[model samples]
Target chain A: MTITTGYIISALLLFGIGMNGLMTCSHQLRKILAVNLMASGVFLILIVTGFGTDGSAIDHVPHAMVLTGIVISVSTTALALTLACRIQQRLNRSADETAEGNDDD
Target chain B: MNGGLTGMKKRKQSMKGKFKRKDWQFATLTSLLIATLVTFLCWAILKEPPGEDLTAEALAPLFVQSGVTSPVTAILLNFRGYDTLLEVMVLFLAGLGIWSQATVDPTNPLVFSSPATHPTKPNFHGPGPELILATLVRILIPLMVLVAGYLTWAGGFQAGGAFQGGALLGGAGILLILAEPQRISTIPPALIRFGIVLGPAIFLLVGVSCFGYGGNFLQYPQPGAGSWLLLIEFGAAISIGITLTTLFVGGRPDPKRLKGTDQP
Candidate 1:
């Protein structure tokens, strides 16, 4: 297979795997990781799209778009991670309170 | 990690055991269908012919002429600058969200009004970094700083840009924070707020200024586009660095709340 086709196929497989993981995973952290994996797959596709065919140079627009995508994805990931941490903390705190109440009984 | 993996495996096994035969059959069928669809899509891509290089031929040259030698930088900071501006705002908004979630009560001045403590102390019982990590950070910070500066400057002509430089700077900041998270609290809130907003604020101000000059919004004054682009990149790098570091810290750092309570 041509290099372009190879790259595209790998990226597509990555996207499929990531989506499957996202849909099937029960854990929040794993879901986040799946999302990140999906993002990386998209990034790869974007970069590959910039690749020139027939000896032409790579496209700069897609490169710029990928850069912007990377930054935005990072922000989203941070926010998601923060939410996950808060949820875990709240869950643990409630569990502790329940344990204390049971001890009193 | 091995224990966690095994625990997860056990849970998955128990969950599978609870599912009926029909449920398992359906799930297997769905997965097979999805896999077939993905394979077909890949095959379609492989069968497609190579397309024209319109981006390289038409857009790249125009972007480069905007007083920046690097086409990607020119596109990011000039040709499609609105996207970059909004991207910074995305990061800024993330910081704002984290700040809002911080336990630091804004109305309570007592918690946030403390003075700076010594920087060397480890405040949290959270797993401390190894001696090797500390030594690596000490040796690498200056080099990272230098590389970041170089990347920001080289963005005018080469493959580097504000984002790359900012990421490097942010990495350095995160390393330091990991060594002593409480030291993050030593930074004044006002300064942190300014750092988070600076990039978007400057970008908007510049865009608005163009309106005053009767040019289209975000159009750099024709004569000094290079200098204008550089200034914007510098502001953006600083803000991006700050925003990334704040994200890593996971909360708005309050110097007033630090004081002696930060010590372990």
Candidate 2:
């Protein structure tokens, strides 16, 4: 009972915080962190929701499902971050070359 | 005394505020629609019953007899096997995306020799490698491996599971990548690909191991559940570790080379 309540409250909080971060933050890393926080919050609620009805062993179904959820989240986040970094690298390089050429000219 | 580019950003922001407010109606409508859809879906899922699920109850034959405490393990390794397969696919996609982007392409748009990020410094910091940091990393790597194994073993009975253990192991690999980003190697890639396949393979193998006993893919007996879970988790650890490491290294500059400064 307590666990579910805790998860529900925290999940909402995380959702709000993540939304705020996504809205206000511009850096890619910060955006990822916010998204991750939101994910973790939802996952916690799901696991809590799985708590057994007649003491049937805290619903393994949700646990199992969330297990996969975590993996997929991490994988997608990794790929997104890589994309961001690549873009940053390109931007930095372009900016540097322009600065160098202008200095010489 | 000290003037950097930070002040320019603030100035730009304040200057743009007066000229802002271009698409207020569109932004508001889109955000409201998204919020409504998200909220409605979540409420529906939560309101759904406790026993009306086929996927949840069908496991009676495949797993969870009458009075069991850790049916959770069985659910993870067995019943919901297809979901696990899809999860592996996610990791595979992440790894592949990173792989393609990180790979050296001659025609890709990037500056090779911009003496800006990496001026002609010998080691960029101090030297080839600091003895202390290297030694610390050496000590930590082996410990992380042991921890990963333990997390895998503990998942069946405790809160630790394959994904958690696998991701942690993968974290260690990412740390290693940070040190040697430029010096690309096939080992990480191979390991990730292996990790991608290894987890499902072990999971399916153990699940099928129960088929002869008149059970399905992940059905577990009394004592075999623990052992079988251990095996699957071990495979999970390896796969997750490699795939995640590959993803990070693929995006960053090679440990030995800068991203924009390295030439083909």
Model 1 chain B poorest 10 in a row by lDDT? B109-118
- Candidate 1, residue B7: Cα displacement in angstroms equals 26
**Candidate 1 CAPRI assessment class:** medium
Native interface contact recovery, all models: 0.67, 0.54
Per-residue CA lDDT of model 1 for B1-264, tens digit only, reads 999999999999888777756566765776677699788987776777657776578785586469798888989999999999999899898988877765431222112211221222223444556788779988888898899989998999999989999999899888777665545555677888888889788878888888877889899888778988888888888888889988877765543444445442
Model 1 ranges with Cα > 4 A deviation:
A99-105, B1-30, B104-136, B254-264
lDDT by residue (B101-151, candidate 2, tens digit) is 654221211212222343222223333346776777778878888898887
* Worst 10-residue lDDT window, candidate 1 chain A: A96-105
What is the C-alpha DockQ of each candidate? Answer: 0.61, 0.44
Q: In lDDT terms, how accurate is model 2? A: 0.62
Q: Which model scores highest in lDDT?
A: 1
TM of chain B, each: 0.76, 0.62
